[model samples]
Target: MDGTPLILTSAERTRAARLLARFTDSYENSLTRRPIAPDEDRETLAKLLAEPFPEEGLGVDAFFADVVDRIVPYTTTIAHPRFLAYVQGPPNGIGPYAEAIAAVLNQNCNLWQISPAANVIERSIMDWLTGLFRLGPHSGGLLTSGGSGATKDAITAAIADRRTDFRERGLQENHAPLVLYTSDEAHRSVVKAAALLGIGLHNVRTIPTDDRFQLRVDLLMHAIAEDRAAGKEPFCVVATAGTVTTGSIDPIGPIADLCAKEDLWLHVDGAYGALFILADSARDALLPLSRADSITLDPHKLLYAPLEAGALLVKDMAKLRAAFAFSSTSSYLTAIDDAHLLDYMDHGPQLSRSFKALKVWAALRTFGVGAFRTVTERCLSLAARLGEHIADAPGLELMNPVTLTAVCLHMPGRNAEAHAELLTRLHEEGTAMLGPARVHEQACVRACVTNHRTTEADIDLLAERLIALAKR
Candidate 1:
């Protein structure tokens, strides 16, 4: 291979662009007809696995051909309109172009001097998100890898806020065991964060929820008091805005009040449902989120952005800075003293970050906020329709109230294994793709209508197929 082959010439660039355009157009057009899950060909897959990396490049044309023939056929079509399995969906139209731009620029967004334009764009995006939640003037945040990362960062800040010497002494030096509180319905990321921070599973309280699946505020208070009596320090409470299983939103208002009374840091995990605030119907329910000390959001979920875009917002930017910022004495990263710009390295763990904010910014700017709001509202409507259909169906039961875009359904005589099998059958049959869930110890099927492309016809088809399958 020659050195000239490494960089694409103008003609090569144009050819590659044409190839990408063709692929995207075909992919989008075939989404509805494609199977939700691929039938794995073990023999072909083995061959692919055994293939070794070549010393010479295959070139763009051959590489694109391989992607189309080998890779695309064996992938789940999550972008399908009927793919209602999880809280994920296809990327918006502008996402790919913005991603390409970001990749070409290869901006390292850790410092202002290194990525001045990217830094400004990220700050602007964060500002818009914080403004949506009414997080106040001093509020600020940084983009993260995903909701898990954002939650972990928020918990770290909470730890620092509660224990000033956490940086030096770590969790071992604390006089008393620090306990973290979250509802049982909360996402597993909360528990994961607690464990990763060395708080230990024993010190993490999983308070029970009420019949509606909302966190029981009374039980939470009791748990906190009990922990305090045992000489354990209760420092932070993690609440859920939109849970994963049934889309149950914990009572943020009551949780915030309790956190204030107990002098505990309140962090709302809104990764699945926070962006629904853009919908007018969800605003009232999520309004109390502003009272939280910190919040975690995923733009990839509701915003229709591409994968791996998550964020953490703090009411007071100083708390986040205190948690992650290091005063490096190194001459290389000499801090730039500019109030208008920020050093992203001070906000999170990664010293080398990508321009993940560009895709999000581009989508928002391209389609405008109103377009997203309409799609979000439509998703909620579709979920509600599914819940209604489930309730009226002969053998199906509505597991939880359709609070957002997730609807859980139960077949009367189905066990957990049976529900799993039914989900497999649905995927195989290509009627639709749904997930399995346990609702109050009973097996159920979960359909999350987060896909913007989903329509009423698709919902009807899913309902009809599910009813027919249940009768079998």
Candidate 2:
């Protein structure tokens, strides 16, 4: 009773741990039966939103009860087996435990001296990822908040690589406007990154895609030449390994060749598709990823790590340091010279970084690499199976090639509104949660097999429901 409320007694800590274990067990068991979308009670939610914080503290038991009764029922069950919507899914089994451990330790991973173990763990994770891409001896990277942050940082480095005086003169003082090229199918992150980094939207060329939704390398070459003729400095080309809408992979090999010929920095956005390299079926298509100057990856997607874990891998470590490292005049943050250890603060934009790498490291270590490979291969197979079912079904058309784990389908007679209606019905009826997408201006339904919990039965059930809906 003498201790502050913030510090719980040993007996209270034991009780809290027991409660957490029980809640986790119950939730995991209920995931399959739970509705994919929440049935929101608007009145209750509005009241909760307007509620003010009390001066008196609620006991841990009452707080736990509130979470179980109020919060849990109103949250979307992304872990549902049939919850096939976007490039997100439930975290791996080890993720939550690792997250809890990281939270308890609360280590600031900015500098090696401050958190030696965390620094080493992050370095190890980066080394493993770089090895996956076969990035050379000089290659290294750092964890980011997500794919967007990684892509933004990659573009920043690309600018530094192209403009020697960029650090001093900045974009406003530059003579020629630097340009970036990416396929129309590339994630919006590329364009967003350009806009954020002072590269105007006009400077970012959206190259057309081929019949298969892959980037047309011929058009890309032509665009680069046209920019050069127009007195614009073409500096970077972003290639997509996994597109968001259809999971179409851009032609990386030819794009790499083009980049090499033009001396342009190549950054591959592999946030969704790159990790599919672990699958034998996808290895050949993504083998050319090693040729990229920099690559962005999201461990949360395929690696089954918890949210907010992304990374940027660069072939030359010195370039990444050059892009971000700033000499701080603060006496408290003296640079340490340890060859084996890295000060993460000098490698990225953030100085106060969290232990985001811990969950990723734990997942890889606990489940082993082969487990992830198996899950990825399974997802690919599931997508292909779903595509086949859609093609064979009456009135259903396969909109895009099942290149990876995203299957795009369309009803012959239905428009965008019909597809939207079907998606809404599926969620409301608890059949399955699918997303609506556009393929070449035609509306389609998209199911991404990013969840490891999903099975063949889940796919068949979803397909059956969709076919019934379309027929009606």
Candidate 3:
């Protein structure tokens, strides 16, 4: 080995920095003009897959060249103004810098001894989120990989809290069949989590929803009563704050009331729409979120932080610690007594964690919370505007009521294949990228304005083009 091959020389570092500057500069400057998604080049892609690793390092220039040329050109431009296919959003301007710094430091965020500042930063972030949801003084949580993991972890706590023997006996040795309640409109992550945690698909009730796509509380109560009569134990109820398809929110207040009466843990999967609470228009609908026993919200979607930054806020910190902690007396992970400090290992599934809090913290501090609220409000307004346009457009119709940013529109006579074809055309023609969805089992297209770059012009153009193209 020639003088430590891993560490770059000063000249190499300079070259790498210049390349990164050029790459970011070019990307930001031409983001709008670029295609939302590049057409697939199978031949070029196959070469990448077939390529072997080289024994020697490709100098800094060649490595940068490959990234900017071979890799980037083929990737979907999610930052594009018209890339409105899903709940995903472009990262805030500050998020990238914070991510870079986080990478540079490479802090292990498991314990205060290893990452003192990171531990407090994560704790402070959870405090703010808990306060935002009005989760009361006893609440605490930790950053997770995403909402799915957060939901799973929340359910873990639910089981531990309800069944004292959970740590010892687990689901296999349970006395009765454990049932978890959720709505038809709830995320697949709920079912997946239950199934993974050995709750079984049969025990997870997917109650039907009303015409508004909201979970029917009456049906929920009926199901719970039936389960109880059948000698099954109902332990937790998973509610949706914002559904993936229509952005529909379940009736959290009534559900909370039911949960309180039945002593069931209420976990609100707010990954898609919970952050809309920041906007004044949606505050009334989302206010009941504070009543939940646990919540899963994604900072990546609402705050525009980079990916892999989802939050799980629980009603009581002790419950979460009890569910996940190995032991408070673990020799290696023990920390000095500090009220502000939290060993994140005791709060969630992970022991080795990234400094995910920094990217979110940086964005909040740089842009201010008001900026996020404004962006959220604007996205809601855009969705309403789009729905109105679709309603006014002849031969096109709104498939669902525009409540949040997801606007689903239908062509009156189109079948499933026809709808799929329309989506393909939308992408192929570079008109815009919209997702295929089903409103009450009828196929439609969904345009979600999660991108801050999406404008009135972008929405109008997509609507007009869609109107003109549907006849064909």
Q: Which ten contiguous residues of candidate 1 have the minimum total lDDT?
A: 1-10
- Supply the global lDDT for candidate 3: 0.90
Global lDDT of each candidate: 0.92, 0.92, 0.90
What lDDT tens digits, residue by residue, belong to model 1 across residues 1-472? 6566569888889999999999999998988888888759999889999999999888889988998999988988988999988999889999989999999999999999999999999999999999999999999999999999999999999999988899999988637999999988999899998999999999999999998899999999999999999999999999999999888889999899999999999999999999999999999999899999999999999888899899999999999889989999899988877999999899889999999999999998999999999999999999999999999999899999899988998888878888998999998889998898899899999999999999999999999999999998
For candidate 3, lDDT tens digit of each residue in 126-148?
98888888999999888998999
Error of 1 at 12 (Å): 1.9
lDDT-best of 2 and 3: 2
Model 3, position 445, has a per-residue lDDT of 93
* Model 2 CA deviation exceeding 4 Å by range: 1-3
Question: Candidate 2 on 1-472: residue-level lDDT in tens?
Answer: 7767787778888988989999999999989888899978999899889999889887778778988998988999989989899999789999999999999999999889999999999999989888989999999999999999999999999999888788899998747899999999999999999999999999999999998899999999999999899999999999999899989999899899999999999999999999999999999999899999999999999998888899999999899889889898998999788999998888889999999989999988899999999999999999999999998999899988999989998888888889999999999989989998999789998999999999999999988988888898
Distance from true position, residue 90, model 3, in Å?
0.8
CA deviation > 4 Å runs, candidate 1: 1-5
**Per-residue lDDT of 382 in model 3:** 90
If scored against the real structure, what TM-score would every candidate get? 0.98, 0.98, 0.98
